[model samples]
Target: LSAGFDVADRCHLAPVGAAFLATTSSGVAAFDRNPGSSDATIVTSSMLPAYRGILLPLVYGPGTRSQRSATPPRLTHGPNETFIKAAGARSLAVLLDVLTRAGHVV
Candidate 1:
């Protein structure tokens, strides 16, 4: 927990009401059917708002995922950071598929 966030801590914000799919800890999510948020899947603090999801495929591809060749490069984690996860080609492909199906017509 290098970020010092408790595992059980919830975000101070909630997902947008009409966000058919919201990026979440486990991946994009669909909230519960009922409105009370009782069985809803919530997003983590790192999630961008659903309104920004149209930017996902453009942002998640290739070097951007790990910032491997970032300009003025920086490591996302500290020396003690245990997890180093990123969306590789296949994962990006899957996300692209999801975005395509989301139908953001220009």
Candidate 2:
């Protein structure tokens, strides 16, 4: 598991192509499958901070079914601003393919 984030505003941005595992009226638990051979999980949980919002990262081991410290957020309405919703796991194959064929991140 990893650290937790608290949403502090309505203009927060969510990374695209990330998968969501849980959601509630106050927060959300989003994650992206590791793009590596180890297959570790990269999870981000955002909660409604009393007034603003925040984002944090949490990492989990590979092949685990249940998440321990990596819990979901309590989100009510859909993300107020930009949000990331990934459909598939990110693997080394995908990263290498993109890096080799698509050009570097600028």
Best-matching candidate per TM-score: 1
Encode model 2's per-residue lDDT on 1-106: one tens digit a residue: 2222322222124331122222212233334344442211123322344322334232433322332233363222334222222312343334344334333433
Q: What is the TM-score of candidate 2?
A: 0.18
Poorest stretch of ten by lDDT in candidate 2: 16-25
State residue 19's C-alpha deviation in candidate 2, in Å. Answer: 7.0
List the pairs of residues colliding in candidate 1. Answer: none
Mark the regions of model 1 whose C-alpha exceeds 4 Å error after superposition. 1-76, 80-87
The 0-to-1 C-alpha lDDT of every candidate, in the order given, reads 0.33, 0.30
Per-model TM-score versus the true fold: 0.25, 0.18
